[model samples]
Target chain A: MNFIELTDQPIDVAKVLQSVSHPDAGGEVLFLGTTRQFTAYPDSKEQDRSGDAGGQHTAFLVYEAYREMALKQMERLAEQACQNWPLKSVALVHRLGKVMPQEASVAVAVSSPHREEAFQAAKWLIDSIKADVTIWKQENSPSEDAQWVHPTNSGAAHE
Target chain B: MIQIRLFAGATQLAGQSTVELSPTDLPTNPTVGDVANCLTARYPQLQSLAAKSRWAIGSEFVELDCPVESEHSLAMIPPVSGG
Candidate 1:
């Protein structure tokens, strides 16, 4: 079984866990994505737009998606995961609109009879969603300007 | 006319979410590549994203050479940044 949702409300991790939980499955993995407080603008000019040279703090993030295509792609990924692993259930949820700092924006849960398969499936699900889903995130800085983030460059600074 | 939907950076560059192209403006039974070429011709700013973007018919991604039916919805997808 699979559960896929694109919603404007915050992701409900508990509900996702409940949905993916199966009596026969001995292991389950859950991944949650939370909004970060700081983000650097890809372009230095955007930092100038904020007028604060020292630090560029993200005020919030606005997420948008090609909803129809996103759902279809997510479903396809879930099916692919099931085919590759000994999985019993999967749940994927993503939040749209404004997401505040430290709030849950995305959640994924997968269940399998063993820990290894569950771990692998969960990792694959999140990675595939990042690479394939038709969802976009625009970082809203303190200057009240929002810049669309590119997928390739979306990583932590220290990484 | 075939409607081309733009998303993410493509939408920002095009300055509009949707652009329409009449059948007369394209090759007969235009492939996705043909439609992409027409888009770049009309909106030169989109040229940079042409190679990076993926084309989707309805909800599924399609190859550049895939034929587009008149009634199908076409979307130009830039690299995704979702979690």
Candidate 2:
């Protein structure tokens, strides 16, 4: 059973793991991506060290996505990974809306005939999710200021 | 009319979830890039995000030169931050 879901509710890892459990699979890999307390943006202006460094204390994250697109992308990733690997089952879940720090935002679980394939598929799924998924997060400060997180260029700050 | 959905920073920059471009407002046949340009023209603040965003028709991503029609589902996909 391949599980693909996008929810505003907290992710149920037990169910995710259970979905990937198969008789033929000897190994299963589950990866949980949790929201961090602090978010440090990758500086594009690394050459100039005097600019505003982007290590901020993110109180929480507000996640939003193109819902239809996101689900389609998740389903596609699960299908592609299953075809690429000798896997038994897979589950991919991503959280939407407000997510607190230290909470699990994303989960990827895959079962395979061997540990190598499981690990590889799990990694690829997570990586692809980060790259192609339409989801975006807003970093909210302790004082409640919100800043949309995006890959920045030069030294300009996001509005 | 073709309503292009915007996400993430593009949404924030545009101050709206979607940008509406009427058929009469555009040329005879518009490409994905033309619609993108119309977006920036409509919302100047979205220049940076619009430039970086990828235009998608339905679930598949399309390049700038790809021809777009009003009936097709369109979306502006910003660089994703999801894990």
Candidate 3:
């Protein structure tokens, strides 16, 4: 019953945590991804070997996605996560538009009867979001290049 | 005619996000696959990306060949990198 699509805003993580907490839920897991100053140089072996300066300091990021479909994907992802784990509640929020370093980009919090299930399901949601959803990210790096990341044969931006 | 939309990079490639094209005029109501082919034909940059991209009928991701009626709002959704 909780899903959102929006630009930057003041987040209430504590509220989300409280909402999902229940007497039967013994463990809660949270995943927070802040904007790293540098883009995680993916394992592009050839790009690394070419030595085009591996540390690409990010200037800013442009995040975009197909909102309606992304929300639907999130629903499916949550369903899959819940199926895989005995979870009581799941809360996920993601930010879009230009975000600077050290800013929060996305967060996933899961409440379950145990910690392991919460942790595993949260991880799965984030990974599936990256691999499947039609969102795109364009990173403006100090390396003097801007790159667009997307899935092969897909239309979603890497937001 | 269905209203088709593109967003972000896909929009950039297409030069616009919303396009109204006649679906009934075609041999049959076009499918998501047909929309993709038409898009690629109009924008050559889409040729490579089309293989990986997906189409959405409303809130769900539908196969490229999923039949789309005239009133459906088809969307071209590229991958996103939101945290």
Candidate 4:
């Protein structure tokens, strides 16, 4: 029912999971999201320099969020999940500021009396965080240019 | 008095994180609409965005008529993207 948040550093999924663990909890699920190195359009000018095109595609992403609102929304979502699921604990951590490619962007850890609830709650928290939270990231790449990415059904490039 | 917060592009323009205004005498409480008008008076640049901008009293999104007092932190949140 409690969540801790910090705007700096990469998220430690294990630490978050551990912090929310409970004696009666029988299932734990952890989700970690990392920045992808490539732009939505891989063939664009912002291609990887090392030529390991398949490697992490992003250089750095600047993250901004409505801190207070995000916290409250997260709390509400956790409470809803607890009500709908038999969860003993739910912990979500998001990294703000500039995050490098391959670095963790967000983490959600949930512990419940059953694996089904834990899994479902973890997935729901991540999805809702992405869709509802007022956090934004501008992708920075090797070309010294940055682009703001917005969600699209086609997953098209934002440029 | 009601405190207004600036964020993202709005913060960049305001040059400060927070601004305080006296919407009305204390006790009856000032509504978000009153706060918006006060914001426009203080920052003319915000006049246009005020109509569409989301207002947050503390952490929750509130309507213009929601009663807000001096103690709450009112913030202007522009559109943002995050995952």
Query: Which is the leading candidate under DockQ?
Result: 2
Each model: TM-score of chain B? 0.95, 0.93, 0.84, 0.82
Cα lDDT for residue B68, model 1?
A: 80
| lDDT per residue as tens, model 1, B43-81 | 999997766677889888888999987777799887678
Q: List the residue pairs that clash in candidate 1.
A: none
What TM-score would every model get versus the actual structure?
0.88, 0.91, 0.83, 0.71
Return the lDDT, model 3, position A29: 85
The numbered model that scores best in lDDT is: 1
Give lDDT tens digits, candidate 4, residues A1-159: 567474687787767988888999888898888887775552334553454455325678988777778877878878888888888988878888999878888888888888987888899888877776767677777876665444332111110
- What does candidate 1's lDDT look like per residue over A25-128, in tens digits? 99999999988787545555644536445555889999989999999988998999999999999999999999999998889899999999999999989988
Which candidate wins on TM-score? 2
TM-score of 1: 0.88
Q: In each prediction, how many residue pairs overlap at the backbone (N, C-alpha, C within less than 3 A)?
A: 0, 0, 37, 6
Q: Report the lDDT tens digits of candidate 3 across residue range B1-83.
A: 77878776677677787877776434576778887877677679877756666677886778877988888988876654556
lDDT (Cα atoms) of all candidates against the true structure: 0.85, 0.84, 0.71, 0.73
Pairs of residues at least 3 apart in sequence or in different chains that clash in candidate 2: none
